[model samples]
Target chain A: MKKKRALALLLTTVMGLGLLTGCGGSGSSSESADSKDAEEGKTLSMMCIGTTADAYMEGYQSIIDSFNENNEFGVTVDAEFVSNSDYKTKLTTLMASDSEPDIIFTWELGYLQTFVDGGKIVDLTPYLEEDTAWKDSFNDGMLDQLTYDGKVYGIPTQECVGTMYYNKAIFEENGVAVPTTYEEYRQVCDTLVANGVTPVALASTPDDAWLVSQYIQQLANGIGGYEYFESLKDGTGKWNDDTMVQAAKLFQEEVEAGYYEDGFTGVSGTEAEALFQSGQTAMYYNGSWETSNLDNSEYCEVSEDVSCFTMPAVDAENAYISMGSVDSSYAVSTNCKNVDAAVGLLKYWTNAENASMLLYDYGRMPSTKVELDQSKLSSLCIDVIARFEEQKSLTPWFDRVDTNIGNEFNNCGVSISNGEDPQGIYDGLQEYAQSQS
Target chain B: MKSVFGNKKSIAVFVLPAFIVYAIFCLFPIGYNIYMSFFDTNLMEKSTFVGLNNYIQLAKDATFIKSLKNNILMVIGSLIAHMPLAMFFANAIFKKIKGAAFFQTVFFLPSVICGVAVGLTWTFIYNGNYGLLNAFLGAIGLENLQQVWLSNKNLALFCIIIVVMWQFVGYHMIIQLAAMRNIDSSYYEAASIDGATGWQQFVNITLPMIKPILKIDAVLIITGSLKYFDLIAVMTGGGPNHATEVMSTYMYYQGFNILKYGYSSAIGVVLLLLCAGSVVLSNKVFKTDDTQM
Candidate 1:
């Protein structure tokens, strides 16, 4: 009896150990999750818009290292770049779940409105008011886009405008001169087509429909102004108005004219960009954010020969306004346990030294109004920034301004590209916008 | 009392762990998902009690209706590939042809590969720029027939379905082959002595003998395709404007992308009901008497 009892006790102990080990598995996953929060002795996590594959991450990391070595707050900053397309989804998910990183890169207007409404973002008005130097550090009217209900929600990191980046080498080789007027732009494309080179590389894939729509929106803004879109959003103006219809018809004309590549209706943004970078296409209409891509020697063959010009106005009288906005500005999340540290990092990042480091290394335009020494700036970047500053007025990008109907509007662009009637596309978008309200 | 799982109680105790595990991990989530279908929820926010608004909304949603039609077509495709075609292959192998084992392995190899890998390989094979399909068509002087296989909205779902069929026809063939091997050799021997043709032996004997196993296979295939997720998720993500949205992918999109958790739960409920109904329908179609065996 004693031996049997002893054997039973031994088996029970073994079983107990097995159960204990099985229960321990859950503890390890939780530990790794918490380690993300605990690892920051002085490190602040700044979520930005770029993927690991993007060349811009290496440039951003150097700035982070510089900040770690020298900062008033004695905190090291690290940037985690979520891809541009996935960034908004990740931010909304993280914000709703109360797991947002310390500082978030955000778009302006209604794109950031949801976070403000949900009380998930910190009001930066008091911070701006206290630091007059930092407040004055931004260019005129830059802060207005980031403010909501008379309170600031984010800091504009870089002012961006969409422009037609042309291949100077290709144009010079083909003996085609750059266009100065809207009519001249069309004539240049006509000449390029006669010479057998694709004039513009436009991607019409569903994911990149925004690229085409942005060009249209820019054309519309050049024809009208911000008020036209605002009126449309507020139900005062219709998308099927004469101005929009004209823009759509012009896009279709360009498509039929063989100005874009043969199979561009299904081509993706990267593919179009690749064609442009390979110098097969003379022009690529994209944002200033793509400046880094154009400058990267590994990706762009004509890096040195690429230059930018504002997309010409449909009406010569209107100041040439292109789709411009604050590119991926920074905001502090309400869920951040250490807001002061996050704000400090944001301030450090936008300051002259780190901003210039980012500019020189990554070709990023500075958000702060500090003057860049011409000697240090790339000639192409300098020229682009000069044009960006010269604009009398900057209309915020169409998609960011109208978050609720933006993606649907982009989809309409795709449908139109794929041979759907423009009127039908606009009608569908109009109905969707109505449903949202 | 002795007949009440006597001498097998320890075995039962050993199996208790697995039984409890299966019940907790599998059954509970399905039950909870059904319960969630009645409410309107966003997962992170407060869920409202909306008796059947989600269901009502689902019925009216055009995207959901289109997805339902696509899923029905997918079911027919799966049934044709796994049932009749697989049976044909199984029957051919059962006749002890030369290199039957080699062909069996060749057929079963695709089923063993991960779905995501198969999807990626096929995506390349269907690519427009330098794909094998385009090259083959071009070589045959049929260039006009070539297409961007996975991009066109009308062709994307069919492309995915063909890949699905190619990937799993072998698995079902193996299942039917197992059932075929179980049939007594005496039956075929007796049929041969009676001057019955080979087709007659197969139609009269092999099929009826494998009816019960085929019922199980039908249930497996139907449920498997009903809740399919990974291949479509990796290949297209139901895009070129939700053209390939299946019930599972749609449920994921609503839950994750749009944050419509309550609506997603409603989709989950419908998927469960469809799967359950297919099982019952298959059993009725393949009705069998245990005493016949």
Candidate 2:
């Protein structure tokens, strides 16, 4: 009886300790991911946003592998990637806790500004000034979003503009050409609908609300021009601006016209993308980032027939003010052990050799200009690149402009998709924005 | 050994470690969260102390108000489904209804399945296009009834409540069933000898006997409903413009999504208060007699 009692007590104690350990697991999540055979000072932790599921992970990994093998910093750049959906929340948690990795994949403007204001990011102006060649390599106005108080804190690796991808076979079957004006775009969609085709594939779920907002903002860009966006970015504008209202009305009209796939508000971004990739829909309006997905025959059912054009402007004068911005921008955290090595990694990633390799192998558009090799480019990529070059003005996503307000704006887009009155929704947004501040 | 288990020093030694663990993980965080609620903080910048302004702001915040209403509705829904419905099932099972074991296992099965997995299964069932529910409606010539169940703000909360009902009814049934089983065979035999009907015996004997367990169960149901998060998070993410937003999800949105940790903490404090308030109210409502079987 004594021996049995002792054994029971021992078992209970072990189980109790196990329970405590299980519950305490949250504390050890930030334990460093080790680099094989690399000593303490030789490894730098980096966090990028992608998962192995993404097609571009291959291109991203190749860049990281090359950097690890050959970078001048002699540091092994170990990267951990969270999926796109979880990236913002994870980064915010890390930022709040001050446990952010050395380098982070960041959105350009307001997203990075939150960290900059918190003094959580390293100011990269001095490094940029030291490497004039690397500084000049980036396209004009690309670094402007990352600049705050005359200090640039982040650098762009890729530029992406929203483009309307279409199925060439479906267009030809319906005898419709790529639309060049808003009227023509409407007519093309009208024709597709008349021919029993779902004109566009769009997702409006809350998780994919940005997809809807980007579309509406694209329409707003065409109608309101660059100045309207500038006004909104600066505090002279409101969410209920007449231009925004008009743009939203136009979007609703399109929704009523049966120009989008049925039950789009219930569709996820991936499901909407799949509709276009599988040739279930004629048009897909999304970022240039989707080029690689469309370029590959294995992923895209209409690979040979996929082509893109910028959605035509509502008022021709505001032609090139597009839903476009620098994507996959990298920022060094104040927590970085070695700023030099981090900046060196950033430079190596954006440099011409790797940039062109990514563009050629994957469809990532470079922030730096690289001489195009026509033989290596897919037709779809070439079309997207041409549409990208035609953009005379670009508006970064509203969420990227101000993370909190931008998020609410995305929610407003969801409201619009659900057939809510745009005027009332925008009014509510204005009230929300005021309440937040 | 001088009755070793009765020794105070040994008991304290065993409990101290667990108490410390609980204090660090639970008590400290709750205290810190309550402390943070008075400030307007992003958790990164220097936080400003606004002294109840966070709670004050929550009153005017439409989304938070909507979430609070949703939480109340969820609690009511859970009470209706888990209490009487579970009692009915438990009573039937206690009567040894045919296939009682199989039905009991089937009913208890969903609670064991993770919330995320259940949520995903229901999402597919609720999917607007090609969902099982829509297809069934169509097959029955009710095509007009087909709508995006989750995306429609009006129906979304109720739909999720139905899921909450489905997932936990069995577990609650088992709890009530256990209480029902604990009733002595003698009471029913006595009641049977007295020519009492089954319903009469249950009303006087079974109910009074299980009042204590039922009281505990009511508290569990109410508090669980108040703190519910996962299903809402997984299914719609408190969305279609947060129509289904509950307190816990709204707290997450404020803290993690927008980085308004102070406002989020205020929501957490409200949820905690609601849970505690419900527990006390439930205790009052379920006054137990010393009617042990």
DockQ, all models: 0.16, 0.45
lDDT of each residue in A297-397, candidate 2, tens digit only: 76777889999998899999999788989999999998777789889899989989999988998889999989999999988889989998798988889
Chain A TM-scores, one per candidate?
0.88, 0.91
Chain A of model 1, TM-score against the native? 0.88
- Point out where model 1 deviates above 4 Å: A1-43, A70-78, A92-98, A219-224, A235-246, A315-319, A390-399, A402-404, B1-50
TM-scores for chain B, listed for all candidates: 0.96, 0.98
TM-score to native of every candidate shown: 0.88, 0.95
Which of the CAPRI classes, incorrect, acceptable, medium or high, describes model 2?
Answer: acceptable
- Docking quality tier of model 1: incorrect
lDDT of 1 by residue, A1-437 (tens): 45335534644553454343322211111223444543554556678887654667787777677767887767766678777767765766666455677788888987777667767789988888988899899888888888889999999888788879999988897887777777888889988999999999888665576887887777777677667766765677777677776777778887887888876755778889999998989999988888888877776898888888888887877656677878758898775666777777778778888778777767887777767788987777887887787776677765687764676666667666665677767876676566546
DockQ of 1: 0.16
Instruction: Write down the worst ten-residue block by lDDT for model 2 chain B.
Output: B284-293
